[model samples]
Target: MTWVFLIGAILSETGGTLSLRMASKGGGRAWLLAVAAGFVAAFAFLTLALDGGMPLGVAYGIWAAAGVALTAITSRLLFHEPLTKVMALGIGLIIVGVLFIELGAAH
Candidate 1:
């Protein structure tokens, strides 16, 4: 299903972003390889979602929003990163915006 592929893309993108952070902190070759694989798989999954007839705007919006929210939460859990209330509010807004995009696409 398109939703399945979109979720896959979101998870892969979030993993890729987290891997990038690790690689930046000297996680070295293995983490770097993970980063590359994650992103590549993300794009592949995204393409599959679009090929399954999901609209580009809707798919990309959801993917980007979910990726940011997931990455932020995971970063805080894994790396003691700062996720202030303001940032959380921003993420909420992004989710709302993506919801609007999806709703509009249905019309």
Candidate 2:
């Protein structure tokens, strides 16, 4: 289903972003490859979701918003990165925006 593909895309994108950070911090060549694979799969899955009748605006907004929020959270959890209150607020706003997008599509 479209939702499945969208979820895959979000996870893959999050993984890819984290791996990129790891690679930059001297993780290993494997980390770099994981980044590449993750991003590629993310795009492929995104394409499938679009093909499955997910609106471009809605699907992409959800994908980007989820990816940003998730990546920030994961960074804080996995890398001890600083997640300031402002950042959390921004993430909340993104979630709200996505909700509006979804709700608007219902009409």
Candidate 3:
């Protein structure tokens, strides 16, 4: 199903982003390879989602926003980074925005 592909794209993209962070900390040949591979896999899965009937604008928009949100959360959890009130509010706004976009696309 298209939804499945979309979910895959979301996960892959998020993985790729996290891998970038890892690459940043790694700073060596293995990490460099990971960064390259992550990006390649991310785009590959994204293309499959798009081909499976997800509109480019909607799919990309949601993917980007969700990826950002999840990545932020993951970083906070893993790195003991501050999850301030303002950051939480911003994430809430992003969720609302995604809902609006999805609803608008439906009409």
Candidate 4:
């Protein structure tokens, strides 16, 4: 449950950060709302996650890595950013690392 909440927080936070970047160029009202809502939801879920049993190290690691992966993907799709093979492999490794951390807590 805590890990779930942490993942949710990571997604929302990355989403909010992306939205904010889009809004920076001036998208008017809708983008502003998206950015605001995303950030609020991100922090709320993160706080809830901490209230659960998730360790700080695990939580932060997951949060940051997920954010980086999501942000990279979004940038590539939405902003025409480049993604090399090495970057993709690195992201894959990060995903594996997160899974390992989660699995470590199971026993």
TM-scores for the candidates: 0.96, 0.97, 0.88, 0.81
Judging by lDDT, tell me the better candidate of 1 and 2.
2
Model 3 worst lDDT window (10 residues):
26-35
- Which digits, one per residue and each the tens of the lDDT, describe model 4 over residues 1-107? 88678878988888888888888888777888888888788878888888896777778778888899999999899988889999999999999998987788667
Better of 1 and 3 by lDDT: 1
Relative to the true structure, how large is the alpha-carbon lDDT of every model? 0.95, 0.97, 0.79, 0.85
Query: Per-residue CA lDDT of candidate 2, range 1-107, in tens?
Result: 99999999999999999999999999999999999999999999999999999999999999999999999999999999999999999999999999999999989
Instruction: Give a tens-digit lDDT track for model 1, residues 13-103.
Output: 9999999999999999999999999999999999999999999989998999889899988999999999999999998998899889988
Candidate 2, which ten residues in sequence have the lowest lDDT sum? 90-99
User: What is the alpha-carbon lDDT for the whole of candidate 3?
Assistant: 0.79
Candidate 4, residue 35: lDDT: 86
Compute the lDDT of residue 3 as modeled in candidate 1: 96
Pick by TM-score: which candidate is best? 2
Instruction: Give candidate 4 regions above 4 Å deviation.
Output: 103-107
Regions of model 2 farther than 4 Å from truth:
none
